[model samples]
Target: MDAMTPPDREAPAEAPIEALLRRRWSPRSFQDRPVPDAALASLLEAARWAPSCFNAQPWHLIVARRERETEAHAALAACLSGNNRRWAPQAPVLMLAVARTTFPQDGSPNRHAGYDTGAAMAQMAAQAVVLGLQIHQMGGFDPHRAREAFAIPDGFEPYAAIAIGYPGPADALPEDLRAREQAPRQRRAVADFAFFGGWRA
Candidate 1:
């Protein structure tokens, strides 16, 4: 039972910095409002500016509006476990992000592609926060089905899908979820995870 908060909160005095540090979070309850094309475009542009190794920007995004795809959306919804399926359907946009396995002119494995894609995803999510949007990254989808359904090219690997929209009422979420809706954020202290100079623990 991952916890969350109701959609209502006072915007911080400094919105941009607050959005960067405080506004970003993953919540399943999404309102059905239409996400503007310009905002979406800006989010993608932020991802485009993320750093990549050797300038090999290999992340690919395939976006789908939940209402637009009948069979596909149903299949996608079913692909997620019951809990995720509940609120994911309410999101207006779904993005399937992929990474290419080969570098141009080099047949060698592109080991860093996934890392670069992850960075781009982080940027996109952060940008969404700045734009008053919410995004949930899902690891429960059927990757094989996604590849076939989207006709993903041979070199590309389907990695993750994100559900994007505005936050919905906590009441719309399941009872178990509603209880933890306004939970506070948590993170490990820096000393716990970061090492100073050498391997002397």
Candidate 2:
């Protein structure tokens, strides 16, 4: 398992979790194969079902496969952070997740737009594992560049760039990324972050 893999579902746990959640990982290396349309639709469908504030479901995804949209893929790659640019370019599918900051029904401000978008991404990640694929989501990208490149409409915010593909050998990544790939997964205790009562004094 790589650093991104979740805890084993079969192992004893404080609470039960889905096996797909345990298997999902955000890996830097990926096999150079185009994602099939059916698999892609499944991933999007999972996202479609995510819960959202007032069921607004603000997430709007723009996906480009390496072989199908070469120029657009390159354009998206260019908008990524320098570190990500190195490894993400090889992914077969690259996507931009955008959020609509207002309700479509009456054009009211949506304070939970970001939160809703996150829920959608979480669904897609889990679905990817079910499809034997992995998705690495990154915040390191120029929003302005992406907006201009993709002609993003007003009131819509570009949230994250996602690289989707089948996991490849870690050795294919740069030496630094390879080391990070094999590192132990770390997380804070549930008690540390999840407060049950009033804020800790």
Residue 183 error, candidate 1, Å = 3.2
- Model 2, stretches more than 4 Å misplaced? 1-15
**What lDDT would candidate 1 get against the real structure?**
0.75
Model 2 agreement with the true structure over 76-123: per-residue lDDT tens digits: 999999789999999999999999999999999999999999999999
TM-score of each: 0.83, 0.92
Q: Give the best candidate by TM-score.
A: 2
Instruction: For each of the candidates, give the backbone clash count.
Output: 4, 0
